[model samples]
Target: MLTIRPATSADAQVAYDIRREAVRHHCIGAYPAEQMLAWTAGTAEDGYASLMASHFYMGCIEGEPVATGMLDVNAREIGAIFVLPGYMQQGLGKQMLAFLEALARNLGLAQVNLDATLNAAAFYRQCGYVGEATALYHSPRGIDLACVPMTKVLV
Candidate 1:
């Protein structure tokens, strides 16, 4: 069974670890090694500690966190939606997205946006997002990642 809950500081590292696993394992073939390494380089405890103030959700299966996502309310964007490698293709990501969209609707957001990873662009489209041209995002670690900008209207 999957349970979704607001993430606290105590769950920071757990969420970070799941993000790391999702990147290192699932994103390997889609992204070059160097890019993946740069993307995941700062997924440490302190980084996630700063995320505690944001609207983040941790998805757990029987009390173990296996997925994580964040909603940027002010920006009306979805950020860092990731499911652990072992938990992929099981509808967890979709469920997390639905949960976040519900929250966005409650917040009166008319639309939401995201820069989808190259591998995940199709999935976002399947979820009703319309994609724009691919763009190069300069990661915080100073790496350029190709991403597709997408948006979905909530209203």
Candidate 2:
């Protein structure tokens, strides 16, 4: 069973590790080695601490965080949804997504958008996000990645 709760600043390192591991393991064939390296380059100082203290949530199983998700209420965007490699295909991603959508709905958001990575587009599609045209997502870390801009209507 997976339990999710708001993440604190102290969970920054764990979140960073999960993001790095998920990107490295699951995004292998979708992006080139150099691009992947650049995508996962920085430490949690790259805004994770603040993010955690804000809208971030960690999904844990037996008290071990195995997934991460964030909903930016102001921007109406879903970001940083990643599940550990070992936890993939177990419906954790879907659960986390549902949780985020619920949060959005409770906040009276009409819609939520996300720039889904190449490897994660299909997953987003399966979860009811609509959008297919690929776009170049300029990461805050100074890397441009091909991503599918997707949105889900909550209203």
Candidate 1: regions farther than 4 A off: none
lDDT for 67 (candidate 2): 99
lDDT score of residue 104 within candidate 1: 96
Against the hidden true structure, what lDDT does model 1 obtain? 0.88
- Model 1 over residues 1-155: C-alpha lDDT tens digits? 78999999888888888888888987778888987887887655545667866999999999989999999999999987999998999999999999999999999999999999888998999999998699997765567899998999996
Worst 10 residues of 2 by lDDT: 46-55
Quality of model 2 by C-alpha lDDT = 0.92
Residue 105 miss distance in model 2 (angstroms): 0.3
lDDT of 2 by residue, 8-35 (tens): 9889989999999999999999999999
Report lDDT (Cα) of residue 6, candidate 2: 95
Q: After superposition, how far is residue 27 of candidate 2 from its true place, in Å?
A: 0.7
